[model samples]
Target: MRSMPNTNTRNLHELSADIAAVVRDVVATGEDAVITDDGTEVAVIMSMADYDRLHLYAELADAARPGYAGATEFRAMSISEMLDVLGVHPTVDRGLRG
Candidate 1:
């Protein structure tokens, strides 16, 4: 599995103030950005190349797991389960997904 580079974290207010600069940094440096809200990490901004790479890896991992379902089916699960499958912490204060 390919590891991601160290991510730069910023609060939502900071990101709102300088979205362009943050975007440029992510695009040019290939390092992801973690967006936080009220001290809680909420989102990530990464280059398309990185997203594609991660998505491909996620697909491969899902396929290798026993009783794995198709991508379409996987997408239908609760956000918590999806995050769990993606190796993300389920307790994080993330936006909900149906």
Candidate 2:
């Protein structure tokens, strides 16, 4: 989320003690929490929306760069087409084809 842990930082023990509270805080704030172990960041807890946005951003950035495998074939396609290149077809994802 940030360069390093901020006020939202929480130790691993805090999670083991009461995960619900930590989760509630994250959802309420809509900001990820950095879960650390002995001052070292181990993981992050974030809302599903944030996680999805992160993945979409990553995919877009990865696809925009040259030599990304499908650049030539999908170069001029719309966003939906680019998604199909990644096998993430929104309209027919997860074998929902009919």
Candidate 3:
């Protein structure tokens, strides 16, 4: 019943007022919704499919880096560590599961 992230950008207050409606729109669009706080991006809502694909890409990219390790080693790295290496903007809280 939650909205998928796509397209429109929403400030925290706007999202807080009607979270369901915003989520509904995102689900219908299968796109990204950028959520901001105080005019700064704070979160994003996106389809799970997109999320999974991104995770795979990240893992693969990690394998090619110097001091590269095997899948087991890469998998052992925390999401934050991976994200840090990928130079992704902070604020993400989820990561691929083993």
Best by TM-score: 1
Candidate 1 to truth, TM: 0.63
Residue lDDT tens for model 1, 8-95: 8878987778999999998877667888889877888988876775578567667866667543444345444555777776344333
Candidate number of the best lDDT: 1
Stretches off by above 4 angstroms in model 2 are 1-7, 70-98
Give one digit per residue, the lDDT tens place, for model 3 in 1-98. Answer: 23322257888887888888877776676656888889877788776766886788686767767677543443466655676777764444345222
Model 1 lDDT-worst window of ten: 89-98
- Model 3 spans with C-alpha error above 4 angstroms: 1-6, 70-98
Rank by lDDT, descending? 1, 3, 2
TM-score of candidate 3 against the unseen true structure: 0.60
The candidate, 2 or 3, that scores higher on TM-score is 2
TM-score list, all predictions: 0.63, 0.63, 0.60
lDDT of 1 at 65: 68
Q: Which residue window of length 10 is worst by lDDT in model 2?
A: 89-98
